[model samples]
Target: MTDEASAFVPGHVTGFFSVERTDDPTTTGSRGGGLALTDGVRVTVRPAEETTVVLDDVGVEIGAVDRVLDALGAQATVIGETDLPIGAGFGVSGAMALGTALAGNAVFDRRLLRDELVTIAHGAEVQAGTGLGDVVAQAAGGITLRLEPGGPMENRLDAIPARSRVEYVTFGELDTATVISGDTDRLTLAGEEALSTVVAEPTVSEFMYAARKFAREANLLTAEVRDVITDVSAANGEASMAMLGETVFALGDGLSSAGYEPQVCQVDPAGATLVDDRDVDGEITGRSADGSE
Candidate 1:
């Protein structure tokens, strides 16, 4: 029997954070206190004789799937595909880990609860040093405020209502591990302030403003990225540099008019989902989350 499933996760922009590690074995990775974005990652998994992972857009090491397989004590070929640029602060790794865990459980009939599946994915990413909060934000979807960080169940999340279109452009990748492991005293301090300001207002514009401030104060902005931000701001558009990446995400046509081919996306209201595929005759039947054709 061959089974397949897919999940869609939105990209997130973390404004600020205070990292905390817990001794709880049930949780994995340090707690990430940040914000979730609408433009993010999408992953699909299928059963195979041997475990294998393939990424469509960017080239990076694939270990999250292996971690999931180890935890489940099962073997299957997993394929993860995403349009978002990997290692570009789009939370590709976190989304892939979460998608693999959820889809693998379904394929194997593991009967794990939703929260359990999320934890498995979270643990994999955390242990791998790929991400800290992307899984939590992806699971919640939309504009999310991660008040407390840990695994899914161990974290506290609240959504900030936003229906605005998001535009983004990627120039290059940044190593998440290198940045996360570095001295983040300034980053953490700026992030704490940004989080407080946004939580008090909780609007899309305010979020973008806070993110921009965090990027600057954290000393994460590159020269090229700064130029993009300046151009976007000059055009009177709200834009912010994505954390740990050489990318800039703007809210409107400000960047586009400045000769940037921005990829436009919307806030994903639904998180990851399972897709049921059945082979009928010579055709395959696929079902969406709502059981629609």
Candidate 2:
């Protein structure tokens, strides 16, 4: 095993989702559609006397990350960096947990498969209540459409099969657990409708249209978010709110055309991957996190 290892996990934004909760965390997940952005988390791992997690230069105790270490039976200093706003529907927690799983597995010589690492991280997020669908979507990458819920073992995933530049602007944060904890009757119904609509013609425009409809029917949009969407539509752009966050995302140059300077990135087709590894000898030329060429 190397003294240090690094992994990169793309950030995921769920446009709309339907939740399914069971007693088992492994089986609990969400059915949704979202984009995996190139703007994501980069995690570095090194052997430490004790386990710790730091993000963006600040020490933090992320529950899902801790749980991943426990599941892997490994301890290390995990450092993560990302520009995506936390609690703003960018799936930062899931990215951290999943990144740790990948980097930790490598650093500790866990010898576990990448799918196993993904399940470990996905389960940790479900147990911590920090996320539902983010881990799986981030793991799969691209414009993701989660057809079935649960971890990699029990879930079915599809994508929009197209690519484009993604644009996003965030207004503020939303409490994900609070919103998802109560009465998903409305959310589930709206999400199912949106999922079906997108499934019929899995296109970027269709995804945006369904997500906008879900945001309206689910009644989760803040005034600022709604206004931005209205402005973007008025400018003849397809835009939608990121589910569970007061963030708006548009495809292509939608936000730019609408006079909003949004953070721009391309869709990440290659999900999570090992960036590099290090030992006393120098860099260890590594393969993908999944152990593929």
The candidate that wins on TM-score is 2
Which candidate wins on lDDT? 2
| TM-score versus the correct structure, for each prediction | 0.87, 0.94
lDDT of each: 0.70, 0.88
Candidate 2, 1-293: lDDT as tens digits: 78887888988889999989999888899999999888889888888889989999999989999999999888889999887887798899999999999999988999999889999999999998888999999999899999999999989999999987888999999988888788888898899899999999998999999999999999998999999999999999988998778999998888999999998887888898887533335533221223222
The reply for model 2, stretches above 4 Å from the true place, is 277-293
> Number of clashes in every candidate structure?
6, 0
Task: List runs of model 1 lying over 4 Å from the truth.
Answer: 24-41, 57-60, 277-293
Give per-residue CA lDDT, model 1, range 1-293, as digits (tens). 34576655556655555555556524544333333444455566666777777777434456766898778777766666555677788787877788788777877778899889888888887777777777877777777777766887777777777655667898999888888777867776787787778889998888888888888888888999999999888888988887768988877565787779987765566666564434334422121222223
